[model samples]
Target: MKISPKKTSLRGLRIFCVAAKYRNYTLAAEELSVTASAVSHQVKTLEDELGLELLTRERRGLRLTEQGARLFRELEPAIANIDGIIAEVQSKTAASQLRVSVQPFFASECFVPVLEDFTARNPGIEIFVDTSDETAERHPVSADASIRLFRQKPTQLESDALFPLRLIAACSPDFLKRYRKGQEFTPLPILVHTSRPEAWNIWSKATGITLPPATSVVRLDSMIAVARAAERGVGAALVPVPLSDNWFKYGALVPMFDEIAELPETFYLAYPKAKAEIAEVKSLRKWVLDLFQE
Candidate 1:
């Protein structure tokens, strides 16, 4: 049977793409603001029209069939191009605005300090920043680019390495004074970043000190919170360099040891490869790369 243009609806293809990206009918439905059954029906209709088995159900979730994966890879870029064109047409002035998603720690430590310089250099360009954790977890971020910490470069997006994370053990001045009174320091308590529990292990390896389990452990989710806790004399925390630099300089926190551990993880500016050619994206990418180089 020959497929007609009317038979392959744009709406159906859009639905299928969302469904394939999420690999869950319910999630696709939620994103599309439709019912799960409606999403399923649309996908089934698309498969019938194309005569291709696009998806398979697994124990945990849906998986794309081989044919489905190939179609998705090709369709995704086409859709991105279409969306970009539509956006450009809809708002002629959009070229002046650059949307960026950034990791909170990086924004606070790195970007914010130099933001003024960027604004001054490109007086006509406006930057909007989003620091949601969700932005870092997904691809095709809802922005021009995302600055995030990653163990490895994400395969789905183009990325430029910003810098490697340098970590150091630090604590409140009072805590260090009590624990290190003219002798080798012993642990009073330890502050742990929930995202990086292996920090203690890494610090121990770097300093070659057999650190015993902490008498108390305070686990926090964000780097900001962990650093704040350490400054308040909660416990000694393994924190990233530059992010914790202000606290140390202000005498709110003191380095617990002289050794600094360099983590394998690095921060990168990532974006959809499809958007690499956009003038705004290219300009912002250059600014970020130059900032880090300095």
Candidate 2:
């Protein structure tokens, strides 16, 4: 058997390998940062130069011809070996890196402590903090993970149920005294969350306070704002239980309504759809779930 020098080229072989592994030229193009047409042309050139059909194009997608399948089986191990060698070589020269993003409020109150544990264990890991609603959606695979607070299902993220939390009304001591008077604190003036305007609405329904006045509401876009306002005796805010831990500990704020308002919110550890289950990621997820043990 004569080896045809013109039959095989390394560059064409790599492209064909990716297309074969993914079973789609478009996806292979995406990974290779070239267009589908370019990948298709490369595959075409390879088949023409070798005088063999590699793929049968179908309406659904490309399928490897029998000849191509035999070739692929023979080539797969070589490709994988090259990949392993490349990884080994790069590992010796580069630092390990992981980037995680989190919602500001959840990061400040809930996730940071858990992260402290991670850093203590993973001193070599460099972390990046991103605070943006876009990152919240998990688009572009920007972060390794995120902790989000939501009343309903958060779109575009693969989420794990960390904890279902209840809300409580809280205010500074001065506000309670100023507004409670000698009336035994019946019908407390409300502190409201700005983002969730319905917080007051939910509280009213829970306490059976029929006919609540429109003037009895205060709103702020962020929980931190509402927490600060309530801490300053601005008004009582219906803040979620976990987020109020700091204020509750320092006596800066205390619960107003003795009856806890159960909200439809849950804290979730969300990540890119692909990265949700690796060993380190799973460790962090379980650590978070354990953080809020009942």
Candidate 3:
């Protein structure tokens, strides 16, 4: 049977791709900012048009069928390429603005410090920085480029390793004084980032220091907030080494131990392949590389 263009809609394919990637209709809906029912409807419609059962309902969730998995593997790259082309066209039309999505802490700690110089050097290009936690996963589609933290280079985008992420256990001077006494391990309440709950585990493994069970635990969603909480003497927190420098310099926080734990994650400057050669993207990429060159 010949497949008509109307039967295979880009919108349906896009929704299907997201659903297949996540394997959850609810998550796909969340990513696309639509209702779960809407996502379900789109997938059902796509399946009907294609005359295939793309997904099978499992006991706990949905799983892609054999045909669905094959389609997904092929379609994902095509969709990404199309998206890249569209972004390239947009970049050509709006060459003056360079939109960058960056992780919140990275933006405040690294990018913001050197932003003035970048703006001064490239006076014609308007730098639009979107400092959202979600930017890491939604880059090149949401913005021209993204400065993201990831365990490894994301396969979907062309990336440049900026710096390795090292996490340090830190607390306010007062808090440290109250708890520590000449190399003695203190059982202070550990503050942790909500997104990285296993921070203490990672740190302990790296430094060979076992964290004692806290009488209380403080959890914040952002690393910045966690660091600030530590500074206020609420508790000791594991924070990125780069971001902790200012706190240490100002005497707001003290390192709990000399050892720093190097996390699997690293900071990377990533952009769509099609936009990698754009003048604005290349300029920004050069600036970031120069800033972090050891």
Off by over 4 Å in 2: 1-94, 132-140, 151-157, 182-190, 209-217, 277-279
- lDDT, residue 217, model 1: 91
By lDDT, highest first, what's the ranking? 3, 1, 2
Q: Against the unseen true structure, what C-alpha lDDT does each candidate score?
A: 0.80, 0.69, 0.84
- The TM-scores of all predictions, comma-separated, are 0.81, 0.60, 0.87
Separate clash counts for every candidate:
0, 3, 0
> Candidate 2: deviation at residue 18, Å?
24
Tens digits of per-residue lDDT, candidate 3, 179-208, equal 877878567787878888888898899999
Kindly list the per-residue Cα lDDT of model 2 for residues 134-174, writing each as its tens digit. 22222223456677665666543567776666787778988
Output the worst ten-in-a-row residue range by lDDT, candidate 2: 133-142
Model 2 lDDT on a 0 to 1 scale: 0.69
Considering summed lDDT, which 10 consecutive residues are worst modelled in model 1? 132-141
Q: When superposed on Cα atoms, how far off is each prediction in RMSD? A: 4.0, 9.9, 2.9
TM-score of 3: 0.87
lDDT of 1 by residue, 1-294 (tens): 977565587788888898998899977876566899998899899899999999888987899999999999999878878867765653465457888888787788778888899889888888898765522334433577888787888676789888788898898888988777575766578888887788889878877866545789989988888888998888888888866777888898888777888888778888877677777778889999987742
Superior candidate under TM-score, 1 versus 2: 1
Candidate 1 Cα outliers beyond 4 Å, as residue runs: 1-52, 59-62, 87-95, 134-140, 181-183
